[model samples]
Target chain A: MATLSIENAGKSFGDTDVLKDISLSMDDGEFLVLLGASGCGKSTLLNMIAGLEKVSHGTIRVDGEVVNDVHPKDRDMAMVFQSYALYPNMSVEKNIAFGLEMRGVGRAERKAAVEEVARLLQIEHLLDRKPAQLSGGQRQRVAMGRALVRRPKIFLFDEPLSNLDAQLRVEMRTEIKRLHQTLKATMVYVTHDQIEAMTLADRIAVLKDGRIQQIGTPSEIYNTPANVYVAGFVGSPAMNFFEVTLERDGDQIGVMLPAKLKGVDTPYFLPLPAGGQYHSHIGQPVVLGLRPEMISQATTAAPEDPVITCDVDVVEPTGADTLCVIRLAGRGAKARVSPAFACEPGDSMEFALDMSRACVFDAETGMRLYG
Target chain B: MPQPKGGSSHRTVLDKLSRFLPQLVVAPSFLLILFFVYGFIIWTGYISFTDSRMLPAYEVQGFRQYFRLFAMDRWDVAFDNLLVFGAFYITLSLAIGCLLAVLLDQRIRAEGALRTIYLYPMAISFIVTGTAWKWMLNPSLGIESYIRGLGWESFRFDWIVDKDMAIYVVVIAAVWQASGFVMALFLSALRSVDQEIVKAAYLDGASTTRIYLGIILPSLRPVFLSAFVILAHLSIKSFDLVVALTGGGPGYASTLPANFMYEMTFRRNQIGLGAASAVMMLLTVAAIMVPYLYSELRGKRHA
Candidate 1:
């Protein structure tokens, strides 16, 4: 219903800065996610948008009006909290109708609205019951119902699924995404779970410390992270890093592989990150980032392809795949392979190193190069 | 090798006995409570049916003294006085306590100092505190004269003296002495509240007043119930303060059931009527609590 824009907003508590010079905007009907780990200032930024927190500098505008000085009530927004925050003393129906009642909606209309929301949430039978009487997931539905009954200009959700059990969280996540689709409301969701961000967000803003690391769609952040932190923080089983050096093997440049990199006994040469990207630091230190699935059982595409040889340190079969541990670059690295390779702890395995797809990063700055 | 189960079973039994033997050895204090508290209450009730004087009298007088008690004007005044006291004390204390807790809930500067000042009265014994309050409320010595001495020429804080207004003075003292405990109770509940709930309400466009009244206050139900029970108990059994401050004077204007019972049993020597009145008071208190107890117990069952 409304576009929210924040311009160079910053927050500091006494001496320590919680959020710094943050600027972001969301279009109408977009579900923007503020995804970050704990203490990354994502919640602080959300609070600033909600008017629960004051920004030390800059301005925030909603629907093309400067709302920096507006009160939360006057800002026209609804929020669903992580704890659900259902009124413990009120019935489920009353909880849903509270916002309507506060806005002076007529009794009959409020009743109809509450019933509609209850039916939509599939919690009609729980109308008469108090919040304490309902289960965690049901209470969460009531919390959303409380927000849904009123068509506020903006909807703010602060990790609303965190309190539910795993199964309920998944179910509620789907329900919330569906609700957003149906309502087409402007919503901002904050979460520490990347899966939730990847599944639900139209565009995810990855944050760290007090700054945005990257802002883009899920695929862009996963396929091309701006930094090593972004690349490592966005994926599961996490991308592994191997410290290497840039070397010139004639006109084609590639990073020299360590002895434990399997197939090549002497040296392994992969494409030296495109162009003169790392040419300045030819012999300097650099780290290689590779995902688990990238290195699999060797295929017969090209026999001369860069392959690594290593002795398997351990093998773990997870029904779907067998996770094998081996020494690569003199450090432990895990390779995901098919369950067919019934390798044991002491077995030797021929694992190919897919350096072409592997990301490269500067060791000093932790920024991706040719990622 | 021989089976070790039997030997270990004996050792386990001995171990359990050794562990709990200290608890069994410390059972006398429990019996002491059963005798001194429960046994004495039964003895007091038994004495209520007898026409006892200064010494204990075991002769039956049927219900003669209870009938006389019903006719006494002082007893009537004492009954009315308790209702007045209970109404004013509980309501005033709750209002003051809730307001204080709410104000302190805002991140105030010197919270510890304010809390100590509010709660200091609870630590003082009502017998002594009541005496001090009596001296302070005395028309000539305490506040009335001091303010009048400032050349007001007309000042009357003499509610402690007037028959109609004397009970209000007792109420003032009760609320003053008990509000601190209520404040502490409310403060703890407010502190334990999920802070994100407030933030959620803020984002939901609820005003600060609405957040406090609609969201915060409703969440304080359990604490309110506990404070209500404690304040009610304080109102009904308010003996020492009334006896010390007003002396149940101004023609029994500040008297409560406990004070009335003491007056009949000790001063008037109407032992049988005093016991009956005490039992009646107990029944009345129980009557007030029955619905509450039923609801509380039923709530537990439903849970």
Candidate 2:
């Protein structure tokens, strides 16, 4: 295993900059996942580390040695592609042995290595069969076997499980995590799936529009997202954003919600957490970032929780939790409640908002305002 | 009830006509092929057993023409030339075509124009190719005199007139006309190869040459079989090229089997012997085609 450091790395195709001023470093045996939507430069960054692509700006050092000019094979990295890119003409044994043969390994050693990998991957029976003869999952195993036989310094997986079926994808995802733990190899995995990043990565780097938006542990990224984009991109059912003006109500600072209490024209005031950084910004516009789980049925509310009542616009039952869309502060917001909480569209329901977990962002800049 | 019976009867007649329409449309061409192609083959087979000369007389003298065809010195020379020409032509064309295709697949800038230039000769008839090569190989008129004019007095490119070398001239013309078509076949096959496999091989530490030989070329076995089958048939039935370029001349020194059959049938009035030669040519083509067809069809069935 080796530490990989990408320093001030940038890539440009003619005039279009795909990745700009990106700097990331990994400790030995650390799993770093680069997560983003499509066209967000995560795959390009992974390719640069693998030497499949050249860094247009800065140096990439592996194990403290600059490898900008090194060939990919000499750099000693193994990659598993999304397509599983197995050589179709070769039997599974030969496919796994091809890299070792290219590295000039002896026949007996190559055979032993192939046998070991085949047993580890549970594919010994598939050794004599060609890639076309294998199922999708079997082919994925062979692709991994081809990479593992060489015992490279680093493992690079470019959306390797994306091509499998949903059920098989989760199974392989767990297997990859288990393998990473057992092998203790420095791995850099690139994927657009947030769940994969959350489940596999030691630290997740969320990327957007060719820039790193946030880099943290999965809970840190999900709980305290750096900005509105990170808040929205990293979660299922997405964090709700409420555009509201901060009001100084006596000694407490709070945001006024547009929901009515009974039949009155008065707006509901939900108090912010005590002593937030936005205390001095009273009467300024800010976006309140609240995850769906932060708002729930009033029955589950703690005594200190702030409560508000709103008309439900839509309800989506996802088995474990029912997601209710309600209007607050003149914008749509999602609330996660128990499926047993019987409510429908056009029904008035009381939702308890957990103030401590909610974040406020600057309305104009979209940056988080309070720590 | 009577009106309903009449409507049902009308519908049945229309259905019968619809079923017969496709067969009716195909019958003319099918009958024409059966009479002209297969019928003539049977008639030719029968005539080979008779002693027909100057005209076809259908009185059987069994195996007489085959004995005479085997005894003739001209027939021996033609058979020998076919073996030499077919062997060299198919091998050289396949090698040259595959090389050109590999070169073109290198993401070249002017690839469209270059591919068209290579493939333009295939658009012209084989007769045109033979005539062009005939002019180019003429000692007094073409490359020989042209080079001699530039003060190289020892330049001698008179392969067209050289009795011992004239058959190779036919091989050259055939290779030139067909190699580009073969290149087109190979280029498409190369294009269809999964590029990610090459990238994976590169990361595996294989050089560009090794990647192609070990992975890419092995996957192109089907294309190789296809090119071989096509070139084989073209070599066996090579008639117009020999006729247009050499005219079986320099005292019948470079005569191929087809040219020999023509000379015996129409020119020397040895019709029965010509039929026997034609039957031999058919057997040679069938020997190549039968196994190829069986294997190809069997592969499709398994797939």
Candidate 3:
């Protein structure tokens, strides 16, 4: 419905700068998610785009028109808040119909709009009930229904599922995705939950310290993170990092891990050819990045490949896969292995490190070296 | 779940009696709230059904004083004055208090100073606010006089004088005194809101007004109801403010129920009729307060 463009947007509250130099453009009907932890200024950025909070410095445009002076109501956008924010005194029908009534929609049309969205949200039975009487999940639907009745050019969600239980969060996440497909409306959602960003967003903007770390498709961010922080922050159980020195053994290039380094058991000899991203950093200390899923139980001996053996310290069996914690090089390392092997605490296990997909980063700068 | 044999709940009968003995020592003060509070109320209701003299005797002559109460034009005016005052007082106080609380809750600078300014009125006694407002609204001695001296002699601050418009002034004064309390309650409630709710509303593209009126105000319904009941009851039984400010003067233009009942009991010595009016006022308070108390207790129990 509307393309949103934010150019070098920043926010400062008196002396505290919450956001800085944030520039992003969203296509029409795009589902953009601003993902960050609390106080990272994701909500402040969303408010700036909505014409709710003034941009301390920069410009925001909706549908190619500058909205720096536009009123939020006049911006043709509807939002579903995490709290539901339904009027406590008004019934679900009245709450959903308020915006339409405010815009002078006819009585019959308003009723029809309310009924349609109520049905869509599976809340027809709750039409006469006030928000106080409804459960958290039901109140969320009413909030959605309220915004749906407006049919605005954009829909903004600020952690709408954060209030629900885990199962409900998942269900509502799918519901939101489905609703977007059916409506094809432009939407911007803000949440600290990375999984929500992963599942719901067409493009996820990962933020840290009031700056955009990376903005790309979820797959792109997952596979090729902009920096070390983005790599570790986007995944569950986090990616493993260890200081290793790049080395060249005749024809091939690899990084060697010591018998022990500090307290983390990291992989040994992650091979990256000399011509790839960090050829100039030979013998230099670089951090190795290995996703939990990529590290596998190594078997047999391969002289041509790099493999390491470590003492398994603990095993967390999650039915389908076992998270095996091992002490390699005097440090703790995690490997997601098949549960069939059945590892326990204090066992010697070998994990084969795959170099093709392994990432390398400058330890000091925390920027990714290998894509 | 090991049971404690010598726990606080397992006190002996003698220990329980010792604990309750201290309560007995303090029970006499409660008698003031019990007997003089309940006894006079029952005596008044009984005398209202009788043709008793100024000094009531236990002799009933069936609804005779009740008829007198209904026949009095002043009684009707007093009840109507209370309805108007209660409605406007409660509505205006809630609206202004909620607005001020939201403004303060927005992480504004000088929050402590602002809260002090807002809550200053609630800390002052109603008698004090009445005295202050009475002088402030006085035409010849206060704002009107001062303004006329500044060459606005044509401007009339005559709500204090007009019989028709006079009751609204009482509503305004009471709202001013009580809205501070409402603001305090709302500020606390706003602070206690799931901070995530505010973030959610903001991301949802809800304007500040929409977020407050639509999201924040609804979430604060419990506090609103509490403030409403308190201010409503205060408006209904307001005597000090009316008497201190207007003295029910300009020909009883600002007469409320409590003041009228006071006039009947102390000035006119119409004990039977005054008692009836008092009973009616109690019932009126009960009508609003009972459900309010019930809901508050039940919500707590549920929580």
Candidate 4:
């Protein structure tokens, strides 16, 4: 196990900067995931950590020692690639034993290590089989086995499960999490899949356009996204945004609900959480961010919860919960309701908006304003 | 509108003819190859056992020509030259070709121009290659005289005229002509190798040399087999090169099997002996090619 620190790392290919001023450090045995969409430099950062790509600027340190100029092999890191990257010419046993042999380990010890890794990966029967002869999952296991046999200081995975089928990906994801728990090794995994990042990482560094958008725990990122991009990029079905004009109402500040319930103009007011940073910007436009779960059927209709009746445009049942699409301030807003709650398109339903859990963002700049 | 019965019949006939047109177009060439290539091979096999001399003779005298061809000292020398030339040519060509391929694969600038420069020799006919090398290897007229003019008076690059070393000169010329083709084949195979595998090896603590030698080169087993098959066939059928370069001179010292066959059949009127030698050359090529083709076809089927 080792600590990995990348300080002010930047990479440029010709005139285009692929990663810019990225600084991140992980403690020993920490599972840090670099998450981003394509062309966001997540994979480039992973390659730099693996020493497969050179750092154009800044320093990479491992175990508190500078490894900016160290070769990948000497850096004592083992990597599992998205393609599995198992040597096609070698058998599973030889594939796992290759690093040891290259490092000049004795033949008998190499064999023993190979056997141990095969057993650990539950691929003992595949020891003599070539990569082409193995299934996708088996090949992934052998790739992991190859890295594990080396027992390196840090383990780097480059979207290793992306090539697998959906079911296999989930199974392998769990297997990798279990492996990390058992080994307690520092792992830096790069992935474009938000689900993989959310489920696997101890701390995720969400990247956008070669810059870190936010670096926090999965819960922290989900509960409080740093910007409009982070909030939109993280969740499935995404958080809804509505143009709202903040208004001061004596002791409380609130936003007007321009609701047309039952074909009648109803005067409605939804109170904003008190002490928001953007409270002084009343009467100005701000994008109100409300997750689907934050707006549901009002079961008890508590005094603090603001209830608004709106015509449901569409109703989609997704097994456990039904999603009701309704118009909120001239924009489509999705509200999650219990499957048991009977509702249909064109039916008016009262959704209790949880103002405490909602977020506000600046309309011009996509940065989050306040809670 | 409904067509008349006669017009409909004509249209059906035309459609049938159009369906059969591709096969009709290809039939003549197919029959020509069957008769001239396979039929001639069978006829040659039959003639090898006959007592034909000076012309085509129908009388059979089984194995007599074969025994005589094997017994001749000139034939023995020709066979020896073939062995030497084939071994040296194939080994040298593969080595030089693989090295050139590796160097060219280094993402160099002006790669297209450099690749064309190396590959240009493969476009030249073996006869042209032979004649060109012949002038260069000629001691008094070529490199020897040029070097002597440069004040090296005792320069002796006369392998073309030397009896023992004449076959090696053929090896050198043939390698120069064919190694580029081999390099092209190997370069394509090298480019197709997965880049991630190389990176994985690098992180596995293997140096660049080790990654290539231990991982990359071993994976190119199919290309190696292909190069060997092509070189072996080319070596066995070599005639124009030996003739243009050495002319089977120095008392048949540099004569390969094909040259010996041509000399025996046309020049020396030993038709049966020539037929026997030709059949032997065919068998040698088949021995190298059959297993390779079988494995290649089988691999394709499996894939």
Candidate 5:
């Protein structure tokens, strides 16, 4: 395992910058995922790290040595492509052994390494089959086997599970996490998939438009997103954003939501947890971000909890929890309630809004105001 | 709507006609190919069985013409020439074409211009290629004279006039005319190879040479088979090139089967023997093409 540090790395094609000032460092055996939407330059940054693409600016250091101009072959990094990219002409055994052979490993050692990887991946039976003869999941296993056999200093995966079916994607995602845990190899995975990043990354660097939006642990990213974008991107059904005017009520700070939201005639004053960061925003419009899980059925209605009656617009049952679509502040917001407590579409239900974990963003800048 | 019953019946007839239109449009070409290609093949096969000397004859010969054709020394030379020419032509074309294709796939500048230049010879007719090479191979008129004028007095290049070496000259001309087409085919297949595979190989620590030899070229086996089949048929039916280049000269040393058939049927007035030779050429082409086509179609079905 090796430590990789990219200092102010930037890439440009002509005038169009594909990645701008991307700088993140990973400790040895760290699983750092570059998460972003397509065209966000996550893959570009991964390629830069792998030496497949030039950094264009700044320096890439591996184990404290500058390797900016190094060839990909000399970089000691193995990449798993999104397409699996098994050599169609080679059998599974050869596909895994090819890297070792290229590195001048002895024939007997190569065979031993191939067999060990195959046994670890439970693909020993598939060693003699060509890539075309394997199913999609089997190909994915062989791809991982190929990377695993190299035992490289760094592993780069570019959306490796995106091509698999949903069921297989999940299976392989878990397998990758297990592989990372077992080997403790320094890995840089790039994908647009947030769930994969949440489950697998030791630290996730959420990127947008060639710039990193946030870099944080999974819990930090979920419970305390760095900005409005990260808040909406990480959660299923997405976090809800409400444009509201923060008001001061004699040492208590809160926002008054539309009374019609709960089918009530008068407005409801919901108190936000007090903080100096939010005090300056009183009497100014701010975007309030709340995750769906934070708003749940008020079954036990603790005295400190604030409850709001909502007109359930639609109910989506996703097995464990039912999502109720409700209108709040003139826009629809999803509220997660237990399936047992979920009400009908036309009915009104009471939801406990967890203001303790709410995120408030500056309306003009879309930056996080406070917790 | 008012005349519903009759109108519905008329609509059914129109629908039927529309469905039949596709088949109707293709019928003429189908009939033409059937009569001109397959019909002539059948007619030739029958003529080979008859003792049709100097003209068409209905008298059964029962392999008499075939025995006479095989016994002829001229036919022996031509058949031997075909084997030499076909083997050399197919092997050289595939090797040269694949090399050119691999070179052009390097994302080099001016690739379009280079590809067009390499493929330009394929656009010329084989007969034209043959005549042009004939002039160039002429001892007094072409390279030998030019080199001698350039102070190389002892230089002599006269393969076109040499009996043992004349077939090689045809091989060279045929390869020049067809290697370009083979290159075009290989280039298209090379372009369609998944680029990610190359990148994966690069990251696998494979050198450029190893990547191409171990991974890329081996994956192009189907294209190699296709090129082989096409060049095999072209070599077997090579008639015009030899006729224009050597005219089976130097005592019939460069005559292919097609040229032999022409000489026997029209010049020697041996129709039955000529038909037998033509049938043999047909069988040779079929032997190469049938298996290739079968495997290709079978592969597609499995895919």
Candidate 6:
């Protein structure tokens, strides 16, 4: 229900900087997720937003009012911790109504609010039970119910689904996304899981080593990552990298493939789709990045899309798609192919590479060079 | 192939010894406890029903010792004093212990040193504690004369010699010697509590006092029960503190049940009455312990 903005927020513990120059603004009713590996300062940033942690230097504003020094209770935000953090001694109903009771809401009103949230979470029968009586997923619902009952200006979730089992985590992830959609509340979530980020967030902010690597919509982050790190981090069977030199052959600029192919007698030239864009980098070594799905079983294609032969080293079937490992530029690279396009290990297979969808990065900087 | 039977027989002997080793090691202590503790309890139970004076008399008498024990004014006073002492000792100790633990839980800079200082009293025996407090409470030698010497003409601070208030002095000494232990129990439980619960309560707008009273303290129900059972047994069995401090002084006003039993058995040579009172004390302790043990074991199984 409120637009939140943080300006140049930084945090340091004694001599070590934990977060630096974190600046982002959220629109009202937006769902933003901070995605990163452990120790990436995502949880720290979320804590700062909740006012549970002091920002060593920065200004945080809510709805155009500076709230840099406001207490967590006065910041008008609710946090669902990873552990659920329900009052172990209180019944589920009491746990949901605790904040309202603290605010001095009437008994009748508190009961109605608790019942409504219990029904919303489909945990009406569990209201009388203590937290220890409930399962992990049930406790998660009660935790969310507690946060939702207050209707705070902002909702902060610090990996609320991290404690649940795989099946229950997916179910709770859907439930959280549905709640965000129904309430249209401003929510900020922190998680190390990219799948949850891709599925639940309107925009994902990828972080590493206490700094934001990139912030954009899920598709933008996946299809056009800002750097090789972002590209490799967001996808499963992570993007493959191959070192090659950008060479121009009669105005057709592209990366050169090694002669390491099983059936090839000499190195091959793989032309770029829009060859002129990379002409300035001719003769410079660059890293080519491509998703596993971009390379598949060979098919009749246009001249821009090239097919090359390589020896398959391994085959893995994942029900929906089959993955084959092949030697490319003297490194094992995974290529996802249709399960029907079967190839066994030690067999030479022809696969087509989609150059337009591929990504190119500077070998030295690991930054995106061309897409 | 010819030696396989010999090897198997040798392994069987070793296996049997391994199975029997634990019981063999435990037999001595088990037998000692059974004879010294439970054996004396049965002997005492039998003696309570006999007309024994100065020593064990084998002639069984029917309910006469209990009748005499119930009728004595000294026994009546000792029973009443046990209640008063137990009430004040358990409640005041618990209140003070909980307060100290909560204050020390605030991440203070000198927590280690302060906790050690608070807990030092429990390390001293009740006799030592009583002797020290006796010197401090003596009207002429300790606080009263020292204060009067500082220019006040009248400073009366002699609870140890006061007959009506002597039991309270016993309670004070016992609480001082035991509250530190209660504080240690509560402090360990307080340390194990999930800290995220406290943070959540803070965000829910709970003040520090309300958070403690409503959320944190209620979760420590087990600790409270444990402290109650421990303190209850200790108060019922209190003897040395009263002996060393007040000596049940100014009459038999401050005598607890244990002291009464000792007086009747050793000093008065009324063995029957002493055994009757000792059996009553055992029953009281059992009454508190049985339910606590039952609930504790049942809770573990459920968990």
Candidate 2 docking quality: incorrect, acceptable, medium or high: medium
Q: Backbone clashes per model, in order?
A: 7, 0, 7, 0, 0, 0
Candidate lDDT scores, in order, read 0.84, 0.90, 0.81, 0.91, 0.90, 0.91
DockQ of each: 0.60, 0.74, 0.27, 0.76, 0.80, 0.74
> C-alpha displacement of B10 in model 5, angstroms?
6.1
lDDT of 2 at A106: 99
Expressed as tens digits, the lDDT of each residue in B96-136 for candidate 1 is 99999999889899999999999999999998888988999
For every candidate, give the share of true A-B contacts it also has. 0.61, 0.76, 0.24, 0.90, 0.85, 0.68
How well is each residue in A163-189 modelled by candidate 1, as lDDT tens digits?
889999999999989999999999999
Q: TM-score: which is higher, 4 or 6?
A: 6
Q: Pick the candidate with the highest DockQ.
A: 5
Which is the better candidate, 3 or 6, if ranked by lDDT? 6
- TM-scores for every predicted model: 0.93, 0.93, 0.80, 0.93, 0.93, 0.94
Candidate 3: Cα lDDT at B204: 42
Say which prediction, candidate 2 or candidate 6, comes out ahead on DockQ.
2
After best superposition, candidate 5 residue A41: deviation in angstroms?
1.0
Q: Report how far residue B115 has shifted in candidate 6, in Å.
A: 2.0
RMSD of 3: 5.2
On residues B1-303, what C-alpha lDDT tens digit does candidate 4 reach at each position? Answer: 999999999999999999999999999999999999999999999999999989979799999999998899998999999899999999999999999999999899998898898899999998999999999989888999999999988879998889999999999999998899999999999999999999999988888888888889989998999899889999999999998999987778999999989999999888888999999999988888888889889989999
Off by over 4 Å in 4: A249-251, A256-269, A298-303, A309-316, A324-333, A345-350, B1-26, B300-303
Q: Which of 4 and 5 is ahead in DockQ?
A: 5
lDDT of 2 by residue, A269-323 (tens): 7888763567788889999889999999999789888788878878999999999
On residues B37-135, what C-alpha lDDT tens digit does candidate 3 reach at each position? 888778778877765556766777777777888888888888888888888988999888877887889899999998889888887877887788888
In model 3, the fraction of reference contacts reproduced equals 0.24
Which segments of model 6 are wrong by more than 4 Å? A259-267, A300-303, B1-3, B149-153, B301-303
Pairs that clash in candidate 1:
A253-A272, A261-A308, A261-A309, A262-A308, A262-A309, A263-A308, A263-A309
